[model samples]
Target: MEYRSEISEELEAWERKITRKSSMVSRSAKRIQNRINGVIPERLHSIVTNSIKTMVQGVLVGSTYTVHPPKKNRSLQVRDQQAKELIRKYKRIAATEGAGTGAGGILLGLADFPLLLSIKMKLLFDLASTYGYDAKKIEERVFILTIFQLAFSSDDTRRKSYRKISSWDESLSQIEVRKKYEEHDWKTFQLEYRDYIDLPKLLQMVPGVGAIVGAYVNYHFLDWLGENAINAYRTRMIKEENQTT
Candidate 1:
């Protein structure tokens, strides 16, 4: 009977160890998953900005070639070549400077993505005002974008922003905000700004603007999610304690 009891105790101890190991493995897996999910929004942001920039370039080049033909004079040809070279030089500068579309993407990867976002948003607002977009409209758009970001953030870290925004006692639901912004007419949206800042112009304001916005938003959101998750786990613990009592 003693030998049988010793065997049972050994089995129970092994089961406990296995349970602990399994729990550790599960936690580790979740941490890794969270890290992986955190980076996705940043990548998406870069892609969206890049696509917009490419479209703008196509429109600009097509309009230049189709709407205004260069003069046929030899002197004009020489001037045209020089102008082309200058454009190339400027393009290179834009690519490297914070004023380029790629700059936004690059900024997203940096450690200071949030700072970059604030700076870029300010710059864009100024540019919009200069172009003639109404100040109120510009502010509204910015707020809309911020809210859209909070709602659509795929990064586990930025879930905090989602919670904060969601918890607000406002008349606008998250879905409503997203729909309102999305349904806004593109022409009206652009016209609302005082300045006629095209995609390239807007992007050039912040180096790697796409990436910077993505990363910062993602990181912030994920942090919120992490906190909420912890709270949820603690609640479960409390519930278990109450049951025991």
Candidate 2:
């Protein structure tokens, strides 16, 4: 009986240690997420916002200028330039002390950033493709968007998001919500605008950097998108607001 009792006590102690270790890991992850958010600036948020706008414009142009290669060419160049600028701005932000210095540090600084960008790009690419844009051009846009996403984002989370966004099969038979703009039956398209499109739009309404991160994630990441990314962005924005205020 005494031996059994001692064994029980040892098991309980081991469990307690495991629980403590788990708690520490959770806390550390949260702290790391918070730190990453703190490093990204409002300007990076603005870049996200601007990228969404550019994407929207691209969609509109792609829908209306289907046959005109010259016009499409100009529009594509403009969008590309804007995307490049946004990437540049993001790089500047990532280089700061808040964003961390070394590769590992930078990875830590951009935990959720890639996810947000991936979501945004997925939405934009789908929208453009649905509007009768050339498949090659759509693919090009996807590639460019992915590059921009990677330029500003680091970490395993971001990389995974990129892979998810890149791999999304928009060809699946799903419902479509934007009937007026769509060429095919709503039922033919496997995804509804609300699922892949409007959700991103709603996220864009969030104020300041929070909306930016939310919108980016909504448009780019798809299934890989997580609330944790938005939460991390919000926490960082709050910290910045507090510091400035």
Candidate 3:
């Protein structure tokens, strides 16, 4: 009971973080980012759209990351500890991959985008499984993408995404989630992610700076995602427990 209470406190703090309002600086930055995106050519946008679509599609259908079965019932604290370990391992993998590609110049720097995305999706699935969630479900898969959006979106978008994630289980039945999976706004998903990450990742294409930038960005991005995923799942778990009790 004490352990559960401690976790409940941690979840409360995380809830505060995800629900906080956007600041002026962040709003201004998002405005500038939108302006910049507006100036980019449509041809390039189409190309990027196709690329992201393909990458995400491959992961969705691929069996590479689905080997692990969902873990059985465990205490929230035990699940949290195991999730931390998974994050640590994936962080190292992302950093190493980033360094290698970043050192290889423009081509390899571009390659890291999809590679890192794949790694992130895989880790999210693994963490879901660890938390006893069925990763194979369409709703669960879409939830993974929602968590990704929460990590990479601007403040306004973050708030919207957080609401969806917070009430996800209540918003839709399993049948509804599965039936409406194809209705997800994937274009918006890809664009927001690209826009949010473009600056740092673009810098990773430079010859001398690419290597360092790549390693640092990948490491921190994975860390951010890991934290978000943990909190998202924790919130859901706590809510479910409350209902049952």
Candidate 4:
């Protein structure tokens, strides 16, 4: 019980961090990306965004059969510890892939976009299983995307995504969340995600800097993503546990 209290306190702190205003660095980066985006043609933007939107939707559909052994009885600490190990393994894999692709220049740097997205999606599915949630449901799969957006979108979008996450498992959220999921914006999901990563990933195409940028960005991004997933799942578990007791 004491441990749970500590976890809850930690979560409150993390929540504050996520909801805070964007830093100067983040704002600067967003501005730079906006300028870069402006010079780029609208057609090009549409193509890339549509491509990613389709790819992600495909991944969601493909993982529809994902089933876990249903460790619903598992303790949160045990589940989270096991999840951390998996996250470490995934982080290494992403870093290595990023380095290899980044070394290969523009072509491979472009390849990393789709490849990394797939890896990120797979990790989300693994995490849902780890947290004893089934990703097989359409609603849950959409929630996985919400987790992704929470980690990588603009400040406004992140706050919105966090609300959906915070609302998880609460009586008021179920029907509302279902309606929201039906109205989920795949285009915004792709655009915000792309804009967020474009700076480091674009640097990853440079001859001298590509490999290092790729390795560092992919490694840390996955780590950030892992923490976000853990906390999101923890919110639900903590709330449910409280109600039961």
Candidate 5:
């Protein structure tokens, strides 16, 4: 009970942070991203969009990408501790993948995109299981995508994504909940993610510094994603709990 109360307070504080107004630096970063998008050729954008679409589809449909069996009836504190351990485990895997590809030059660096994405999605599945959810459900997968976008998007997009999931039960109920997973805003989702990490990832392709950059970037970015996933899910879980009570 005491732990639940403490977690509830943490969620309250996290809500305030997510809802806060964007600062000047954030606005400027968005503008810069817009300009960069304009500068990049449409052909390249199409290629990236197609690549991400294919990669994501493969993971979503692949047989090997199994969800953790749901942890039935666990307390929130125990669940969260397990989730944190899973996140840490994946973070290390991502860092190692990044270093391996980074050391292999441009080709390997390119490979890291899909590889790291798969790792992140797998971590989300484990986290969902720990939180007593089944990742096999269509709505749950959509929620996972929402968490992914929340992790990778720009400030403005993050704010919008956060709102959609923050009231997840109500928001999810409004959706048609297709089993095919075709309704997501893939274009905007890919664009925002690409633009957000473009510069650092681009530098990661450089020969001499590639390994160091890849390891450092992947390590930190996984940590960022883990933080977002935890807080985002916790927000929904807390909201649902309050309603039930």
Candidate 6:
């Protein structure tokens, strides 16, 4: 009971943190991203959008990926511990992949886009399981992906995504998340994702420093995604407890 209270307080604090206004640094970074977007060609953008569209479906929905079965009926604290451990495990793998590809220069650096994305989705599946949610369900998969968007997006985008999942217990039943996933806005999703990481990923392709940049960038990316997933799931679990009590 005491642990639950502590976690509830933590969740409330996290909620406030995310809802806060965008910092000047974030605003300036978005402006820089806008300029970068302008410089990139539409043809390249189309290619990227199309490619990631297929990749997202395969990774998030396909049966190819499997999460090891987690014991059921665990307490929230136990689940939270498992989630953190999974994140640490995957973070190392992502960092290694990033370094290997980054050292290969432009071609390999390009490969890291899908590679890093797959690693994230994989982590989400494991996380869902730890939290006693089944990722095999289409709606659960969509929710998992939204957590990714929440982590990587701009301040405004993050807020919008956060609100959609804030009351997921009621909202999931109220809306057709499955259909929403089917008709997802890949172009916008990919655009926001690319813009967010454009500079560091761009620098990651530079011959001499590519490896170091890739390692650093990918490590932090997975870390960000993992943290958001934990908080999102924690919020949902807490909501369920409150309703039942």
Measured by C-alpha RMSD in angstroms, how accurate is candidate 5? 2.6
Question: Which residue pairs collide, candidate 5?
Answer: none
* Candidate that beats the other on TM-score, 1 or 5, i.e. the better one: 5
Specify the poorest-scoring 10-residue window by lDDT in model 5: 172-181
What is candidate 5's lDDT per residue for 169-191, written digit by digit as tens? 76544246454356666777788
Expressed as tens digits, the lDDT of each residue in 1-245 for candidate 3 is 78767777777787778778767886787788789888988866776676667655554554545636789878888999999999999999999998889899978876787788888988999999999988776677778877987998766788887898888766677677545545656667677888878888888888998888889989999999999999899878877888899
Candidate 1, residue 216: Cα displacement in angstroms equals 17
Give RMSD to native, each candidate: 24.5, 20.6, 2.3, 2.5, 2.6, 2.0
Q: How do the candidates rank by TM-score, highest first? A: 6, 4, 3, 5, 2, 1
Candidate 5 TM-score, C-alpha based = 0.87
**What digit string (tens of lDDT, one per residue) describes model 1 on residues 141-223?**
33324332332233331344344333333336546754554554533222212111222233333543553433333344333
Which segments of model 1 are wrong by more than 4 Å? 1-111, 136-152, 155-245
Q: Report lDDT (CA) for all predictions.
A: 0.35, 0.36, 0.81, 0.82, 0.78, 0.82
Number of backbone clashes in candidate 6: 0
Candidate 4 residue 59 Cα shift, in angstroms, is: 4.7
TM-score of each: 0.21, 0.23, 0.89, 0.89, 0.87, 0.92
Q: What is the clash tally of candidate 3?
A: 0
Q: What tens digits encode model 4's per-residue C-alpha lDDT throughout 1-245?
A: 76687798779988998999999988998888778877987876776676677665664565433556546788899998999998999999999999999999988987898788777877888988888877776567777878888999999999988997887664335566556644667666667889988878889999988999999999999999999999999988787778898
Worst 10 residues of 1 by lDDT: 189-198
Scored against the true structure, residue 71 in model 1 reaches a CA lDDT of 26
- Stretches of model 5 off by over 4 angstroms after superposition: 21-23, 41-43, 55-64, 172-175, 179-185
TM-score: which candidate is best?
Answer: 6
